[model samples]
Target: MSTTERPRILVVGGGYVGLYAARRILKKMRYGEATVTVVDPRSYMTYQPFLPEAAAGSISPRHVVVPLRRVLPKAEVLTGRVTTINQDRKVATIAPLVGEAYELPFDYLVIAMGAVSRTFPIPGLAENGIGMKGVEEAIGLRNHVLEQLDKADSTTDEDVRRKALTFVFVGGGFAGAETIGEVEDMARDAAKYYNNVKREDMRFLLVDVADKILPEVGPKLGAYGKEHLEGRGVEVYLKTGMDSCVDGHVVLNNGLEVDSNTIVWTAGVKPNPALSRFGLPLGPRGHVDTGTTLQVQGTDYIWAAGDNAQVPDLVGRKNGNENAWCPPNAQHALRQAKILGDNVVSGMRGFPQKEYSHANKGAVAGLGLHKGVAMIVMGKMKIKLKGRLAWYMHRAYHGMAMPTFNRKIRVFADWTLAMFLKREVVSLGAMENPREEFYEAAKPAPAPAAPAGAGDKPKAKAS
Candidate 1:
């Protein structure tokens, strides 16, 4: 905690940016020159691309996350939430998991907190709708889907069964598309074990405000994706808005009403709201305004990247427009963090910092097992693929891109093992409420038998 020691670089959020940024800084900086400290609420950085498979039980949840502490051994990893930043003082207020809030002073700061799911004033969204933002959500969705099956199979009541069998997804982007696909695949596999619940009996709906889905992949691939989903009996409602999900009754803008117990919301993500609390420049969408060099425009010591930073896309140049910013995705986040990290070292060493420039590498999305759509961009050539080949390409790219070597091998192994074994469909729903059984048992029950008395035996026999 001495002010005369090595300069401190404090990184907030341990997602794609924070993890790699610290790693790059640790690699570039000379010993005893600076110290890198990463702060995040969770110790691990989840490979979000595998979340759908995790939800589908295609991969183990434990393997999907890379522990930050284990990877960045040279950097100090603090598990905490950063409450406020006093840019003038170059200090961050951190609320650690175990102790009272304290201020952490630093010479440089990197804001990489990432984005949160964008929800609106929908009546029951906060209370009922499920989000697909983290590993917990993926696991919750899996358990909730399987629990629906349990309800449908056990209950004789037609209304309850109908309510439980219907599943609704609010967005048709990659997250929504892959999630519904995986869950539907899981439900289909699960039906084989159930006596009453048939796959045909269940209804899956994907609703979006846009006329087309997966715009990142060109129109042709998006249309193909829609057709593939529809062929599997999933309904696509486009150019329509969701009015309310109040009382679990989904009222659509087009006058369609459905009573579904499971509603997954992946509409979109907005920049973390905490960025606004800081006295910094923000773009139209509330993202921290950053220059092409990935540094806060007016500041020298502070840098930002990932979903929270509005970084201009220099690679996708147009007719004299050089300020087009990069989109918030794993592809850009990964590249941006590397540059951002290098730029920090460059600043410290008085070397020239380079601007971020990367062209759009199109998009790929897996509809389900052995089914997907991919659009890869190269110079003037655009490659479009679908079906099993596209699925393999999707897996191959993401699997190789999985953050750490430890995770990359495990994910590849999961895919390898999947070739021989059927996907898991069992629901560990009790995980959601892990203490429910303990609380039930702890409830003040009838006084314990008085030394296993004769009176207790007589009462038990009479009952």
Candidate 2:
């Protein structure tokens, strides 16, 4: 919250776009030009591309997240969610993690609220389906997977062992494919420590509605990725969808059924549902409608970008397509943030806004350790790579793009050390309920405080 004297720039998110956009605005603006207040439910920004590696135990969860306060010392960081925005009054109501909701006025607003995991009303999904959206989920997935291995090793019953060893993954996009690949790799190594559990005993199945996996990396590479995973003994079910996963019982549309203790859902993501309350022009898919300039369709004071905003794909449109939109990814989010930041500053200073347009720079996907697919699209020439080389390309590209020199160093260090040291496949599943053990062992209530002074010295009352 800033005084009315200085123009206040209220950023509604602190994720990729919000953090970078605020940084850009602060960097471009002079001292006291404006007060930037960023409000987010989290105190840190999660670099999602590293989430798969984090889940696979290849990277530490904390290293993948950048502390918002440390990076934006100049900006007022609020640990809260913006409930609604009254653009008519230029005020946004915020609900902190632990407090009442309040309104904050702003001159320029940044709608970088980001997206949430897209899910359906599938039976038992809400209860059993895991997601890969954040560091917490990644950590939980790692622990749960390892814990399952433990159960499988210790259990004598064949049914119990089978359930513990079976893992089902929905969606064959980057997240789903990468997660299963890394997890299967980790499990293979982890199985060596168990007497009963072996890599051959564990079952890894990937279900996707799409005809191919890693489509963003091109067909040849995608096919290579599928074949490579299959070579590693992973069951790839393309053009297949999961029907129901009731109580850990997975039934696929293709008539395959299995009992899996771990089922990861990474089908897709949708913009924040709270966007509806913001009173902005939204696209058909519930994203903020923004032009190539990244400005809201009918508002000059409010700007939107990233997964939450439907920004026109200027490069794609320029080439040929009449209806083109920027896909939600880190590449565009980062670039869009910088340009959106400059435009916000320009708007404040009465200057013309600069349009944002960046061409697609291909895509990269790492399958497990030493396995991946990369497609480099340079105009007419499309260079493709697979296997170890592609894996290195994926690491190199994302390692440099992880945000902040501090985080980049930490991530690279994690990778460098992983090469020399064996991967730790320990399970800390108790982390989810750290207090459960204590609660169970804790003494019961002290007999309702012993009836107050009933057991005290009766003679003391006489005194």
lDDT of each: 0.90, 0.93
lDDT of 1 by residue, 310-402 (tens): 998776555357667788888998899899999999988889888998888878899899999999889879999999999988998898788
lDDT of 1 at 104: 87
Error of 2 at 309 (Å): 1.0
Report the error of model 2 at residue 311, Å.
1.0
Residue pairs with backbone atoms closer than 3 Å in model 1 (clashes): 312-325, 313-324, 313-325
Candidate 2: where is the Cα deviation over 4 Å? 1-4, 445-463
Per-candidate TM equals: 0.95, 0.95
Clashes of each: 3, 0
